[model samples]
Target: MAENAANLTATLQVKPSIFEIIAQKSLNDILQPAFRKLAEVLATNFPKRFAWLNNYCEESFVVINWLLQYNYLKNYDSTFSENFYGFKRMCVDGKSLSNHHIELSLLFIVLVPYFKRKFDKKVTLYMIEEADGYFKQASILGTNLRRKM
Candidate 1:
C-alpha cells in the first residue's frame, strides 16, 4: 500500500497549471492606507497626474503580488519584500520635498523594488528605459534658479 501510494503521488504531476499562472498573475497587494491617502492628495492637487499615480499604484501592486508569489514558490525570502516597505516611505519623503529632481528620484525609488521583483521572476518592466535610465536623475533646476529659487 505504501509503495502504491508513493507511485500514485509520483505519477501525479504537481507542476503549476495555466490556471495557477493566471491566478498568480491576478493577485494584487492591499494598498496601505497612507499610500492611498497620498494618492488621493495627488489626485486632488494634480488631477492631470492622477493617471500616472494610478498607473504607479497598479504597477506597485503587481510587483508586491509577484514577489509574494515567488517567495512562496521558492520557499524563500526576496529582497523585494525587504525593499517594498522602505520604498513607500522614501517616495513619500521625496514627494514632500520642494525639489523637483528629488520628486523624480522618489518616483524612481518607488519603482526600484517593482523592477527588482519583476526581474527576479523573469518578467519585464515594460518601459525599460524609464525604469533604468539616468534621465530621471537629471537636475531639473537651472543654475540661476539655484540662487534665486
Candidate 2:
C-alpha cells in the first residue's frame, strides 16, 4: 500500500510533456487572440502569398489543436516532422519555452504541412509558381541553375 502510494506520488510529480504543455487551452485562450492578429498581419503584409490563411484560419487552428493533443505524435521526430521547430523536449530540461516559440512552432508544424496535405491544386500551384520564380531569379544571377523536370 505504501509502494502504491509512492508510485502515485511519482506519477503526479512527473513533468508534463511538450504535447501536454501545448494542449493547455489556457495558453491557447491567452495567445489565440494574438495569433488571430498574426493571421491578419500575414494576410496584410503578404497579401498575394498568404491571403488564403484568412479563409482557413479557424479551421487551421482546429487542426493544429487536434495535432497537439496526440501522445504518439509527441515523440515523432521525422515523417511528421516537429524537429524543424525551436524547442525540443530534451533541450528544455529545467527551463520553459517562451510563448512566442511555441506559437511559431505550431505555425510551422501545422500550417506548412496543412497546405500540401490537403492536396488542393490551388495551393500546389501557388507553391510551384513561387518556386519557379525564385529559381528563375537565382539562375539569372548565376547562383544556381533551375533543372527542368
Candidate 3:
C-alpha cells in the first residue's frame, strides 16, 4: 500500500505563515474543541489534542516549529510512532502549507487511536464526517489564497 501510494504527489505554493496560522487557529478553534467534545460524548477523560501538540512539534519541520510557538503548545509525545513520520515526506516533496493536508493528516494519526479505543470501529463515520468539514474549509481557503496571488 505504501509503495503504491508513494508515486502520487501534488504540489501547491503557500507561505509557511499560512501553515502557522492554520495550525494555531485549528488547534484553538477546531481540534482542541473536537477532542474535548469527543471525550465529553464518550464520557471518558482521554488525553486531549492540546496535550499532544508538543509531541507533534518535536523533531518536526520548520512549519511545525512555527506552529508550536504560535500555539504555545507543549506536551510529551503521545504513545505512538516515535517520530512525526508523514510530515518529513511532505516537506521533502515541496508541498505548500496553505492547504491543511499535513495538519489533518497528523490529526488523524492522533485521533484515530482515540476513536478506536473509545468507540471501537464505530468511530469511522464520525471521523470521516468531522474531517470532511475541515478538508473543505482548507480547500476553499487554499484556492482563494492562491487565486489572489
Candidate 4:
C-alpha cells in the first residue's frame, strides 16, 4: 500500500501555480494628504524654521513629488545612492542653492520620509502579492518608483 501510494505520488507532478499580478493605481491616488502633516508639525514646533513655507500658497510637496517623478531624476538619484550606500558626497545640483532653491530643499527634506513610507508599504504589498513579478507597477505613476529610488 505504501509503495502504491509512493508510485501514485510520483505519477502526479505537483507545483504551485504561478500567478500574474496586475494592480492599478492612479497618480492622483498616491498624493493623498502627502507630507501635509509633516509640514504642519514643522510649523507647530519649529515655527521660525521654514516659516515662509506655511505662508507660501503653492504646494511645495507637489514639487517634491514632481522631482521624484522627474524624467531626469536619474541625474540626482545615482548621486544620492552613491553618496548614501557607497561613498563620498551628496553631490547634488541642489547643493548649489540659490535662495529659491532653499525652499525646494526644505520641501524635499520634510517630504522624503513620507514618500519613503508610502513606497515601503507598496513594496511590502508587492512582495506579498508577488515575490518577484514580471509586471509589478505603481501603475499610472508613469515611473517605476522602486526602480528609480
Candidate 5:
C-alpha cells in the first residue's frame, strides 16, 4: 500500500508540457471581450477563414483551461498565433487607416508535409504582423494572395 501511494504521488508531481500550459492560459483568456470581438470579425468579414479560426480558438481554449486548472503555467512558453483580419471591416479597417505597417513572416514548418501530401513541391505559411492600425490592409494582402492561388 505504501509503495503504491508513493508511485501515485510521483506520478501526480510530473511536470506539465509547454503546450499544455499555453492551452490552459488560453482558456482563461478565451472569453475576454477581445477574443469575442475577434471571433465576430472572423465570422462577418471572412466566412471561409472562420473555420480555421474557430478550430484554433476551440483548441486554444481547451489547452489554456487545462493548464490553468492544473496550475502548470510556469512550465511552458505561451505563444499563440493571432489572425489579423476577418470578413468584417470593423476589426481591421481602423488600423489600416491609421498608417500602421504590416509585416509578414513566412514559415516553412508544415509546408513540406503539406506539399508532400498534395504531391506538390512547395507550400508556405505566412505570418503577418502589423502596427495596431494597419491590420485591414495587411489582411487585404492575404486575401489577394489567396485569390491568386
Candidate 6:
C-alpha cells in the first residue's frame, strides 16, 4: 500500500513536457482573438500575398494559431537556444503579433511539420498548399540567399 501511494504521488508530480505547456497555453489564451486579428491584418497589409488565409474559413484560425508559435533550435558554441514567440513573451501584455513582423518563411518551415502531426489529412493538405505561396515569396524577397530553398 505504501509503495502504491509513493508511485501514485510520483506519477501525479510528473512535469508537463515543453510542448504540452506551450500547447495548453496557446489554445487557452491566444487561439481565437489571434486568429481573427491575423486574418484582418493579413488581408489589410498583404492582401495579394496572404489572401488565401481569408478563404480558408475555419481552418484558417487553426493554421494561423500554429504559425504564430514559430520556433527554431539554434546552436551557438555548443549551447542551444529555442527562439519562440508563442507566449507573447516578446510583446507587451495583451498585445498580439503585428502583421509587419510576420516572417513567412519561418511560418512555412515550422508549420508544415506541426500541421502534419496535429491536424487531420484534409486540413494538413490545405495548409501546405496555402503556405507554399508564402514560402516562395519568402524565397524571393528574403535577403539571405542561403535560405532561398
Instruction: Give the top-scoring candidate (lDDT).
Output: 2
Model 6 residue 69 distance off true place after TM-score fit, in angstroms? 11
lDDT sort, best first: 2, 6, 4, 1, 3, 5
lDDT of 6 by residue, 106-140 (tens): 45434554466456868878989888977788789
What is the C-alpha RMSD, rounded to one decimal, of candidate 5? 19.8
lDDT score of model 2?
Answer: 0.57
Deviation (Å) of 140 in candidate 4: 52
lDDT at position 74, candidate 2: 43
Residues 65-94, model 3: lDDT tens digits: 335422321221221121221122233456
Question: 108, model 6: CA deviation in Å?
Answer: 25
The list of candidate 5 runs beyond 4 A from truth reads 1-31, 51-60, 64-72, 76-149
- TM-score between model 6 and native: 0.26
Best-first order by TM-score = 2, 4, 6, 1, 3, 5
All candidates' lDDT scores?
Answer: 0.47, 0.57, 0.43, 0.48, 0.40, 0.52
Q: For model 6, where is the 10-residue window of minimal lDDT?
A: 73-82
Q: What's each prediction's TM-score?
A: 0.24, 0.32, 0.23, 0.29, 0.21, 0.26
> On residues 1-149, what C-alpha lDDT tens digit does candidate 1 reach at each position?
79768878754664646764445433322333345567768877888968567557646554554444344323322123323322112234544323454434434534665666558655454466655553445444322323454
Cα error, candidate 1, residue 56 (Å):
8.6
> Can you tell me which runs of candidate 4 are displaced by over 4 Å?
1-32, 71-149
Instruction: Quickly count the clashes in candidate 6.
Output: 0
lDDT for model 6 comes to 0.52
Candidate 5 lDDT, 1-149, residue by residue in tens? 79768868855654656775566556434443465467668867897868566556544444443444223212221213212111111224443311121111111212232335345322222222334336677677664424444
Error of 5 at 76 (Å): 7.7
lDDT of 4 by residue, 1-149 (tens): 79769878744644322321111122223343545666766777888996656554235765665565332233433222222332222335645334454445434643665567668989999887784453455454455646544
Model 1 regions more than 4 Å off: 2-12, 28-38, 41-149
lDDT score at residue 119, model 3, on the 0-100 scale = 78
Residue-wise C-alpha lDDT for candidate 2, range 2-66, written one tens digit per residue: 97688687556546567755655344344445656778899999999878877777665656554
